[model samples]
Structures are given as C-alpha cells and as structure tokens.
Target: MQRFQGSPRSVLSTLLLVLVMGLLLYPGLKNIAVYLFSAITGNYISGTHSVVFLSCPNEQVGKVIARTIVEKKLAACVSILPKVFSIYNWDSEITETTEVLMVLKTRTSKIHRLTEFISGSRVE
Candidate 1:
C-alpha cells in the first residue's frame, strides 16, 4: 500500500511539472513564432493588396511603366529584372527573345489604370 501511494504521488508530481513548464514557455514560444512569421510574410493583413506582374518589351519600356506607376502613386514598389529570355508564339510564329520583366507591386484597385497605361506604352 505504501509503495503504491508513493508511485502515484511521483506520477502526479511529474505531470504537474510538465504543466508548469508548458505554462512558463508558451508565451515566449508564441512571441518567437510571431516574430519569425512576420519577418517572412512581410506583415500581411486581411483586405490588403496584391502585386501585379507586368512585362515590357525592353528595359526602356519597363522603366516607363515603373515610373508612371510610382509617379501616380499607384504602387508601393516596382522591381525590374532586365534581360529575360521569353519563348512564345506570336503572329503564328515561335519566337525566342530577351525582354525586361517588371514586377509591379501596385494595389489591386489600380490594376485597370495600370493595365491601360502599360498597353498604351507598348514599344514593340
């Protein structure tokens, strides 16, 4: 009877210790996770915006698109990658060519205007 009672008490102590440790570490662990997620995800919130990928025929054309978006305050940022080779069919012919890729980080609301502006500025 004495041995049985001691074993139960030891098990209870171990469970209680685990519970206390969990309680103590939870807040710290949660904060660490939040920090890591924020660092990786760029502080996204519900109802925020998405970026648009706009391509231009050349660096000159891409720069024009980027400048217009920024000057109009339609975008927060525009990252341009030049000299990308694009392989596609145009006018019933397969074409392999180099072009500039502009990642236009604009709000969804300005997509229509941005598209119109980009379409009008095509230099091909």
Candidate 2:
C-alpha cells in the first residue's frame, strides 16, 4: 500500500488523483479542445468532413506532400502511414513497391479547394 502509487483496485484514490490532476493540468491542455468538445457534445465536429487518401513512393515524399497540404490548410490533418506494400502496373511493367499512405482529413466543402490545390501542386 505504501509503495503502490498506481494501485488499480483503489477506485476512490484514482478518482481523487484524476480530479487533482485535471485541475492542475487544465491550463496545459488547451490544445485538447477538439477532444474535449467531442466528448462533451457527443459529436465528431461542427463541420462536415471527409478523408482523402494518397500514396507516395517513400516516407520523405509522403511527409512533404502531407506537410504541404496541412500547411496550406487544405486538410485539417494528414496522417502518413509508412511501409505499405503496393502492387501496380506502371508504363509497360508490373511493379511492386513499399510506399507511404497519407490519409488526409478535411471538410467536405473544401473538397473542391483541396482538389484544385492538389492539381495546381505537383503531387497529383
């Protein structure tokens, strides 16, 4: 009891610790507004949004494209999942390669804007 600061069976102890921690950590959690909002409202978000997926040959290119979209606000967030195996036909050869997959989340209203941005940029 004296050494176990993280005892799983102490429900009251956990609650009290969590309450104190919340109060102490409130100011540091400003960036968590979206999560808190979703929890309180039981809604994903205010806007209608969708995710668009794109794959790049490597992590570096994937990161660059993802970063560019996010920086331009074309997407709310871009997740780069690496080491994905892809098989496809390019030119006259069948090719298999390891790639990075980017899942971009953005508002539905911004789809056209996002598309335009992607077209204007060299990523498409």
Candidate 3:
C-alpha cells in the first residue's frame, strides 16, 4: 500500500510537469509553425488586414487557385500577376523559376482557413 501511494504521487508529479511544459511551449511552437509555413509557402500574411503572396506553377494554376479562393469567399479579391521570377532553395538546391504570382487580399482571421483551402486545392 505504501509503495503504491508513492507511485501515484510520482505519476501525478510527472503529469503536472508535462502539463506545465506543454503550456509553456504551446504559444512558441505555434509561432514557429506559422513562420515556417509562411517561409515555405510564401504566404507571408502580416498586419490586421492581410495580403498573402503565393506563387503558382503557371498561369492556369494561378487562375484556378485565385478564382476558386474568391468564389469560396475566402478572399475578397485575388490578383494574378502574369509572370514573375522566383528564386529559392528546395531539396538543398538553389533554383530560379518562373511562376505566376497570386496576390490574396483578406482579413488576418481568414488566413488559416485560406491556407487550408489552398492546401486541399492540389495546385501546389
């Protein structure tokens, strides 16, 4: 009975420690995740009223993604820049490529949902 009581107290202490660690890490982890997502996708959503910059492989994908976003009411407006040069590192290689730029205008609150929609759109 004494050994079992000690085990329960130790288990409770471990659980409390885990809880505290989780609470401490959660906000920072969230920020890091947002930063990484923005860095990787280039959807650099900033400010209260936000603009997200996304690059599509071509005019067609750009149009499709832009139009679909607007139609779904995720963005008030989306403008497609016909041709843009993008230079970035991928797969440990620096590559320069031509792509269409899609400018998305929406409130900051909509950014997460908009990102989710784009993620499922399969345009990449």
Candidate 4:
C-alpha cells in the first residue's frame, strides 16, 4: 500500500478551503464568520446601542417606567419581566423581595436622559 504525504502549506490550504466551504454551506455560521472577519479586519458593525436594566417594586411601576421611556423616545424597546426575586443588603440589613425587571434597549446617546428620567421617577 502506498502512503500519501502532504506539505504543511498544502495541509493549511486544504483546511482553509474546508473552513470556507463549511461557512458557505451552513447558514447559521454566517454570523460567526462575519464576527471573525470583523475582528480580523477591524471593521466592526457599529451601532450606539445600549441595554439598561432597572428593577421596579412591582409590575405597575415597571409598566409605568417602560411606557414613559418609550414615549419619551429614551428607549426603543422595553422588556418587562414581572417576577424577579432579589436578595440584597439595604440599611445594613438583608432584604428579600419580588421585583419587576425592566430591560431597556436604547442608543448610547440617550443613556444619560434615560438614567435621569428613571432616577427622577424613583419613589421615596
């Protein structure tokens, strides 16, 4: 039986060919390929997007905050999660409570305004 031998350069070329073929054949790999390409080329897909997380005392408060931010255009979208069990230290004591979580998606340029609005809406 004859054995086949390949040079390192040929092996690398074969591997690269396989990788390109795999990327082309698999649709799900498109995102990964784009990300790797971006990293290698230093050509990032740019957007000034930001995600902010806020915890509210209850669903009503969460809804109010969400509606206000969206209405004011401070956030493009707000996702409200109704039940989040949080444990934290307040006033040197441990506190446990069920809270609503708000995830706000907005432009980084509006983060300052969004923060100001949320802080001003806090209940004493």
Cα lDDT of all candidates, in order?
Answer: 0.78, 0.82, 0.85, 0.84
Q: Report the lDDT tens digits of candidate 1 across residue range 1-124.
A: 3555468889999899999999999988976676567559888543345778776788987887788779988788999998998999999999999998888776565788777876676554
**Residue 110 local lDDT, model 4:** 90
The candidate maximizing lDDT is 3
For model 4, the stretches where C-alpha displacement exceeds 4 angstroms are 1-44, 122-124
Candidate 2 per-residue C-alpha lDDT over 14-118 given as tens digits, one digit per residue, 9 for 90 to 100 = 888999999998865853775577668877775456889888888888887888889999998999998999889999899999988899998776899888887
Worst 10 residues of 3 by lDDT: 41-50
- TM agreement with the true structure for every prediction: 0.58, 0.57, 0.59, 0.61
How many backbone clashes does every candidate have?
0, 0, 0, 0
Estimate the lDDT of model 2. Answer: 0.82
lDDT of 4 by residue, 1-124 (tens): 9865999899999999999998788975765676667668876455446889999999887887789789999998999998899999999999999999889998776999888888788653
Model 4 vs. true fold: TM: 0.61
Candidates 2 and 3 compared: the better one by lDDT is: 3
lDDT for 14 in candidate 4 is: 97
Candidate 1 structure, TM-score to reference: 0.58
The superposed Cα distance between candidate 2 and the true structure at residue 42, in angstroms, equals 9.3
Q: Report model 3's TM-score to 2 decimal places.
A: 0.59
